[model samples]
Target: MFLVTGATGNVGAEPVRGPDAPVPDGARPVLGGLDDPGTLAGARDAGVRHVVLVSGGSAALADMSDPISRSLTLSERAVRDSGMAWTLLRPRAFMSNAPRWAPRLRAGDTVRVPFPDAPAACVDPRDVAAVAARSLVGRDPRGRVHELTGPHPRDQLAVLAEMLGRDLRCVGLTDGQARAEMERTLPAEYVDAIVRPDVQEVTGRPPRTFRQWAPAHAGAFR
Candidate 1:
């Protein structure tokens, strides 16, 4: 059997379970997180053979001092030492996260957001899941770091305008202003984590576009 940890979207895990917590018993586990001893111990005790980590795909590019990147680095190290087959997925930003702007889009003709001009090869979650599945099924996908990305790239302004089919406007926010607004609820590191980089291709098939994803979930905008 296969167990997927931090089974949310493209995200990280904060293992808080104490070292004495119940050890997970399974044949295969997609262990996520390196900071928590319980999770690692659980995986080891469970007799797990194959493990996959859902780490920040491109977060490796960040500076070593960056906590997020540092944590991922630690995770990679722990997984390597686990003596189990491991697959690390490094997927870029998720197109699914675009819906975060739905409220602004519905409020007015202009959607106020940060990084208006940045282009992202925002990948579809489906593609990421597919790759994980392939790795989980033991297709000889061990000891590999896969950098997943969208098939193409597009700026938010163009994507929103096209999807809404109106003269939607994009209001860019200054770095400081954006930070202040975001920090009201989110940590500064999370605010800085929002990066968009264009990708040229996908591993297996053509990835979906924001143009495609946005319309399909148009109900969210309304």
Candidate 2:
């Protein structure tokens, strides 16, 4: 049976069919996180044969010196060595990240955020999940890496401005400032984010763009 770790997460939640996916029979819970290779043994004993891992774009950077990259790299290795069929998904930042500007936007028309000048080909987590579901349900792409992305690179701040129908102003933070703000929630690992056709090649459709995603989730920003 297929077992998706982080099933409640952004990408994983999508494949489980919106709010949640039904856990397969005999699915045993693992105590330690992905960083703990010992946890993987539970899946094999639970009758799981395939593992679809949702890594990050940083893994594509291949810099072991970076802790995020190192941890993801180690997790991938554990999955590979686990002897179970595995597929690795490395997706760029998610369109859902746009909603993070909500609190600032709601407070006022001006928003100060990190990396205002940076653009990302931010993907819809649903698309990432679509690819994962295919890999889990099918036999192809086994032991392969799918670098997922949206249709194009975009200025996320500008997109939010248009979506919220406000003359939103962005105060771009310096590298040091950006690092300080970002490090609060996640470790900093910068990479050259790019768009990929893997989503279309696998799902036979174009990946959703931020334009498409923004409107559907505009309520969050509003």
lDDT of 1 by residue, 146-194 (tens): 7666654667567667766778778778867766775554333244443
lDDT of 1: 0.62
TM-score of model number 1: 0.69
Q: What TM-score does prediction 2 earn?
A: 0.79
Residue 210 lDDT (model 1)? 68
lDDT of 2 by residue, 1-222 (tens): 445567667786676555445655576643456556667787676677888888876665556888887788888888888878888888877889877778888898877766667766778988998898888776566888998888765677777777667788888779677767655434233333556888998888899878777777778987
Highest lDDT: give the candidate number: 2
| lDDT for model 2 | 0.75
Model-by-model lDDT, in order?
0.62, 0.75
Worst 10 residues of 2 by lDDT: 184-193
